[model samples]
Target: MGRNEFTVAFAGNPNVGKSTVFNNLTGLNQHTGNWSGKTVSNAFGCMSYKNITYTLVDLPGTYSLLSGSKEEAVARDYLCFQSPDMVVAVVDATCIERNLNLVLQILEITSRVIVCVNLLDEAQKKSISVDLKELSRRLGVPVVGSSARSGRGMSELKEMIYNMTVNERKTYVDKIIYSPEIEEEAEKIFEKIRQKCKSDRIARFLSLRLLENDEEFNKSLEKSIGISVEAGVHKKEYKDMIAEEIIKTAERIFLSAVSFKNSEYNKRDRKIDRILTSKSTGIPIMLLLFGVIFWITIVGANYPSQWLSSLFESVNQFVRDTLTNIGTDNMLVSVICDGILKTTFWVISVMLPPMAIFFPLFTILEDFGYLPRIAFNLDKYFKRSGTHGKQALTMCMGFGCNACGVTGCRIIDSPKERLIAIITNALVPCNGRFPSLITLISIFFSASLVFPFNSILSALLLLSVIVLSVFATLGLSKLLSSTVLKSERSSFTLELPPYRAPQIGRVIVHSVKDRIIFVLWRAVAVAVPAGLIIWLLANIYIGDSSLLNYFTSSIDGFARIFGLDGVILAAFILGFPANEIVMPIMIMAYTSNSSLMEYDSLTQLHALFTTNGWTVVTAICVLIFFLFHFPCSTTCITIYKETKSIKWTMLAFILPTILGLTACFLISNISRLIFMLAG
Candidate 1:
């Protein structure tokens, strides 16, 4: 380490509050990027304490050092190779037993370590107490109790880190001693590694890995050492013995160092899980939660959306008046106000509120630790459909945005399973699609009912559509897995984290900053150009009719085959940039109004649609098509980026369009047949 600087790596299991500690320590001075040649994200931050700069590296959270997954590989490789000055193993105090396994693994690599037991408040709430002094003695390292949420023990943690790194304080290293047989085998491998390697620390860790017969580690070692260490004929037997011994040692340390006062420390979590994960009630509860969120969003968003629309409308009118007064060309003014300004307003006004409400609500569920249980409940279904269990998690991410969901498929280790996840991700309705789905449900399905119940019905109706989407995702996943992406099911370990009280302020900040604003910005970027193009098509004349009418008329006959008119079809095509603008585009095409015109209320919008020949059957077909249509342009681009193949991206685009057309055609024909019989 340099005199003025030190590098400290933070490592821990997922959900151990590792991120909270990193953020608290580093504040805003951080940047994230992928590890070299890996898709796993690694973050680094720097902070100054007492004139010394402490550079903090946040490793990907993993349960163990053994490289069973990408996260474990990145974290294990960094620790073994990068050789940071100090390793801070952040453990969940509430479940120190399970966390200690990782700490034990880290200790095997380096002696300069600190065990930070986080979430102490949650532990205390459960009547679980840890004797920090005892734990420090057992682990032969510094152990600090912290509640990163409350900023507790942060100063002490930093001071201890400073002392250990700057002062070169000698610390006791309490190492795990394997059984005599395993130790002898490790010693032999250790000697071989030491003869070939310059670093004594790395040699010791490599011996244990070699004993385990870890092929990946062996290949990595060969690359670094420029030599191969061939195992003896009995290496497999020795590896099994060594692995069993490590497990026993971890169990022994956990038994000695941790204790619970309640004996039923996890009773509350178990009780909640019983209800949330019950076979009969689980799916219904999940659906009900979805409906409640949609209801809250639908009811809560109305006033804000209307106010934002009015505000934007006022701005547009002001811009128009200013342009006219300045003698600006009417065509230029129309392009700016009617085309660009109005479309941007419609997207923002429609998208912002629902996103603002939904993201925060979703974040709350996440913070409360319910999302993994959702994945857990859905895992079996995914497995039965010939996909990996983790697809449930990626699918849930798709609800926020398909592009993000596609990126998240890296968690699945199998390439085939990951591809299945990426291809089917768009089947779920993203936040961009929510406004369109919700508005149509309100205007067409729930408009006739009275106040309170009307909103409830709208929410239920939207939930049904969402359920349909989920089924589509599962069905397609099954079909694709069985055919194009045929593969055996892969298993995954899911940790059902203990539920914690969500931090409202943090949840709000994260959801708004990370999700709502991020997605809204993307939508706006696409909406502007789409609006300008729509305006040009409407204004630019061709022959006796405008270009917009000529194209709509040409497509109308084919569109009616799917129970949609040419105008609606044209709107969907133009609205490919962002799904939120699809309805507005349809409105613009149908009313022959200025591209920027805002409907004051749903009643007026309903009247306009009816005047254009919309009916119950038409609304039903439109809803079905909207639920299953092709992904927006952003998602298509994301698919291409993630897959790095035009073939898969095009297939992803075509699959959903085929499903949507087929569904609409069947529904339209069935409805027409029933009408003919009745007449």
Candidate 2:
């Protein structure tokens, strides 16, 4: 421990609120980086406690320090090589025994540790009794129970860290001993590491990793020590057999040291799982949950959508009339009023309302811990598809943006599974597509002449499409794994976290900050340029017809087969930068006024579509095309980066295009034939 200043590292198992605790301790002062070229994100921050500054590094969350993956290797290397002044090993109090495995591993490396048993509030809520002092005595570490989210026990935790760092207090950790054969191998590796690295405090840890044949840690050590310890060990030839024995021995030691007892809550988990994960009930419940969320979003979004639409339309009318009353050229007036301003108006009006309602609701469910249960329920399907269970997490992220989904795939350990996840991520609908889907459903599928159920129908249909994509992804992944991208399914463990009461304030702010504002800004930015371009094409006459008219006529035949026109197709293409701009572009083209924004009702929208010769076939085709179509701009960039191959990126683009066009063509043909027969 250092006297006045100390380096404190926070380590924990995944999803134990370690990041939240770190953020609370350091506020917003944090720096992020990749640890030794691995994709896992790491962060370091500084916090002052009792007149002493502690530099705290937050390690990647993992189940154990076994170095089974790149992230585990990063955490293991930092703790071993850096040798922080004190290590705060945070464990979830509710799941103490499982989390203790990691703590035990950390203790083997350094005696300078304080076990922070967090989530005490959650534990108490579940009526689980934890004797903190007894646990502290048993583990031989200073135990502090905390709920970091509510700021409880944080001051005490800080005091404990400061005291340990400055030698004002001391703690011991229980020693774990393996069987004679395992102990002998560990001792042999420890001897080698001590001689090579000249540090006994960390040698045992290094020895165990070596025995496991951890590729990540071994590579890390090679960079640190300028030699491959594995190569040297194998150069002896007999060491390979010795290394195999070490892994077998370590696994026995690990299982012996950890005891998983079933509590009353565990029974409840079983009872809940019987229904939640049941073949008959799980799918229906999932469908119902999705439908309900969409219904809420649709109902809540309508008034705001109407308000925003009216507000934008009023501005558009005023600008157009005032400019026309002046001596300004109609072209100039149209460009200013319709092209630039109208596009901005429609983007804000159409996009903002739905996102404003939907994001918070989604966030609330996430915060309440429902999504994980959803994932847990679907894990079997994914496993059968030859991917890890946690690929479901990336799929959830896809709802926000597919690029983000692709980025989140780093959580999956297997290279082949992660690639498969990335390839199929675009199948999930992102927030940008929400407005277009909502508008289309409302306009085309009204059950009542007076009231619209479009948003409701749209949400359900979108959910169905998402479910269908899941199956499609699983089928493709299985095919790929068996044939071209053949690889074994990487073993994955998922934490089905206990459900909790969600914080409304946090949910709202997070939703607004992370989703609504970010997407709205993107929509407006893309909308302005798209608006101007649409206006130019609509107004610029080629001989007798406008440029937009010419384009529409040129693609008319092909569009008919696909149940779309050149104008709608072009709008969708332009909207690739941001899907929120599609409806605005469509309206602009249809009205021939760069700024017509008064489509406040689905009836008005339907009238507009009807006047333009839209059919049921067109609506069905549009829906199908939107479902299977091209990746957005951000997704394209992500594809390029992830594959680092232009070929895969082209495949991502072309595969969707072919599927979307074929699907739309088939749907249009069947729909037109049915209509003709019925008539």
Candidate 3:
């Protein structure tokens, strides 16, 4: 520890403004890693104020430190064992009563603490107010009021932290007192703990944890103290008594420190929820909102995509001319122009615009706090599928990117449920797949409609595909739960946060920085090498035809069985790296163009596909396959990383591919039979 350095940990419940405060204080100086010997993520950052450096650890959000889940265990263990210089408890001002429970638990572990009452603006909006002085007086710690989103009171927060860490301020610690009977029993256990643990705060904490019979925490405490406290009698009864006492004490403290002009702080949110989460309108409204977003993404991307494509084309031509003028080798120019530049251009031009629009809109919903309601609405369905209700939340994440969805499965407490979420996540189409699906729908289905209705029809078609994908997720989840990854549905508490107006600028910055660019970069990394190999296969000759032609001919029979041609099948195989590149590969294969070509409009693309023997049935089969096929390379790698088992990874890959092939074959043959009978 340097003289000017200190460590502080930020702990709080979920949906509080803990993350916002961390980001505001530390800005971009942060990185994340898993806790030692655990899968839970730990975030750390550094900030310098008043010539003193502060290293902040953002602990995972949990309601309590009772060790019921990995998140709670990680948060509790770090605070108890690591012994940071100070602990900052970030609580929601509007719901301060519920948040104070975690704060009281932290007070039992550390004397050095600060209470940050965040979301002051939200509290004010609801006509609820917190007396900061009264809160600090009752808790015997410094209390700061802040609206982190608006950057209010940040300076005071930093100053208070500095004062406490530099030993310039003497603050008292007020520990909560349990009921008479529970306290007497806790004192008995504390005496035994004090023999091995020297710190008074930690000894009491261990005593309580032992009484609670927290298996995970007990193991940790036993290892630390070099003794087993599991011999305590009536442990379960003691835990229940202590828990009831703590809740009563929390209620008493909340009454003293907070006041409300209106008792119903969530009146507005409740009113909105009636319509958004109603049995009748909930699902339909969700579908309509998503449909509108997809409609905007599909219709809005056209002009910008065209502009970008044209710009890239002009740059490609200039590069080609320059290479010729400089006497560069023709082969090298072809590789640079056709293999690398064209492929990269095709991906960015087509993928970027839709993502740019879609991510911001998605962020708006997240910031508005509608996503939890989505999980709330879908929880019963997930429960019926024999998976945890939290899986519904992870499934929604798949819409942005399946890799993220796989990563988001960490929230589920059960190992079995988490694995099920990871495996079935790919059934939901990611943003990468959306471009291909949208383009195909526009070219094949929407273009046949009248002018204003075409875009609406395209959006409806995309929504149907999405609905089908959700059903696939549910069906596969059920099958996996019964057969391979059998588990009972685990329960979890989902907090429906109060809605707030989204900050447009921050939403854009966060979405673009966190999601759009991150996913795009991953796709680009895989697409580059895949592009080179694809170009070589198309350009290299074998017996008076290109190698691609030879391979497509060999696979034509099997491909036809799925209502697809060899060229389309080969394109999908080569497009495993990135779904966004599938249409480009298909175009390159069909036109026999040496480079990836860009069509000016869907009309031109439709004409090309028709010339290549595409019909409505072929398009329908392609859509079904797209919805059900194997996960992309990025998603597969994420699954392996999360599961750490090759067996599960291979199963994840095979399961979806089998479903896709079976569905496409059945649909194709049944349609052909009907046509034959009609003729």
Candidate 4:
């Protein structure tokens, strides 16, 4: 490393604007890469000032280092092991009392810390103020107050960072004093570990850890010291005393350094929470919000989707004509234009517009802190289903991508509950599946209605599907808890963060970069190959029929039992690579095309479906199956990667597919029975 280069570790409790501060400092120069030998990823960013380069590492948001959660362990290990030149403790000034817990804990490990009081604007809105000088004096570290969203106080924060790392100011960190008995016990082990640790604070921290009987910490201690050290068991009272004292110290410091102008400032938020979290209004309001989001997405995406479709088709024809004019083989022209371009653009046009509309709306809700209320509202259902309420958060993630939802299941502390969440996540339709669901709903369910009403009706139907998916998840979670994954329903505390106004510009930019582009690129990657495969299957003929037809005809009879013909089911099987290509595959097979084809609008798509004998029963069955079917290829692979067992992965695939098949069978047979009776 260069003399001017420094590594700074940024740490904080979740939702404290730590990432915002990092983003302000780093801008687009950031990378989310895993540290050596760690599962949880930490974000890294590089920035420069006055010819000196700083490497900022953003740690996972965790409340306490003592908490043995995998995520907290990563943060703790990095601060203890890596020995970064400086640490920045980002805290929410609006809730300084809660945030000080992590900051004080960091002080115990290292005194070289800058306590950044972020979200000062939010605090000011609430009529709260922090005495930064008093806080700095008490903590014996440099403290910077920053309102990162508006770039307020950011310059001071950067200058403080430069000063702390380069100038190396001396800090006398105030330690959390425990009871006499705990101190005496810690002293016995402190000298034993002190020589190796070389810092009094760290030695005392490790010494206290030895007394606490933390197995994870003990293992880590063994690694650092290169030998196992045994400790006598401490009484429960002593351990409790240490934890109690830490909080008491934080409270004392907060009381001395922070003040509120209006004590009832939060009264307004509490009143709003009453309705948002009320049992009766919560679910209804939640449904309405999602319904409106869907309505907007369905209505707003129309013009842009059509426009992109026309633009891509024009580009396709131009490319095709240019190739033909150059005497390029007709086969080559068809492969490039009709096969690859058609399916790829079909996915892009269909998938991009809805995502562009959906993710930003979702992100706004996320930034406004309403998402936790979603968990609060749905906690009872998940609790009844034998899982923690946090499953709701993961299920919400599934709406964007099931693969992401599966990865997010790590938040569930219980192994059994995490598995259940991962297995059931795909029940909720993701963005890739939304296009097919909306198209089918628009064509069959709401086509006869007028303009805005039709969009609203489609949204209601879509919301109904979402409701059913949630219930299905609950029911499946219950079944798994009762069956192979038997476990008691564990209760967890869901924190309802105070609501704040979202930063709209940051929300738009982050939603586009993080969600829209990532998903669109994935869809395109899978679509091109899917398009080529469709072409080969359609063009390769055996006897009088093409291979695609022969295969569909073979499965046609079996498919009839579920109210869907062969082409639809085959499309699903082929679309395993990505859900976005399913409709395109179906269109190609239905038309008996030698390559992929595009339907200009939902009207044209509806006509095509009708020509292929798609009845209401077919549409309903497809929609149900669409919701229940095996997850897209990405999600299944994520399931396997997480579970690390073929058995669990196979079960994940089978459970949803079985549900889809059973639901389709019941619906198709019941519809037929009613029709026969009426006739």
Q: Considering every candidate listed, which one attains the maximal TM-score?
A: 4
Clashes of 3: 0
Candidate 2 residue lDDT tens string, 229-340: 5533322333444434444543443344323343466676567667777889987987887788887777777898788778877888898888888878988987988688
User: Which is superior by TM-score, 1 or 4?
Assistant: 4
**Which runs of model 2 end up more than 4 angstroms from their true locations?**
1-10, 26-40, 43-60, 70-88, 108-114, 133-142, 158-204, 223-225, 229-263, 314-337, 447-459, 504-509, 528-560, 592-597, 676-679
* Decoy 1 TM-score against native: 0.88
TM-score of each: 0.88, 0.82, 0.91, 0.93
Clashing pairs in 4: none
Q: Kindly give the stretch of ten consecutive residues in candidate 1 with the minimal lDDT sum.
A: 29-38
Give the least accurate 10-residue stretch of model 2, judged by summed lDDT: 29-38
Question: Per-residue lDDT for 236 in model 3?
Answer: 61
Angstrom error at residue 675, model 2: 3.8
Which model is ahead, 2 or 4, in terms of TM-score?
4
Local distance difference test, each candidate: 0.81, 0.72, 0.81, 0.83
Candidate with maximal lDDT: 4
Clashes of 4: 0
Better of 2 and 3 by lDDT: 3
Per the 3 Å backbone cut-off, how many clashing residue pairs does candidate 1 have?
0
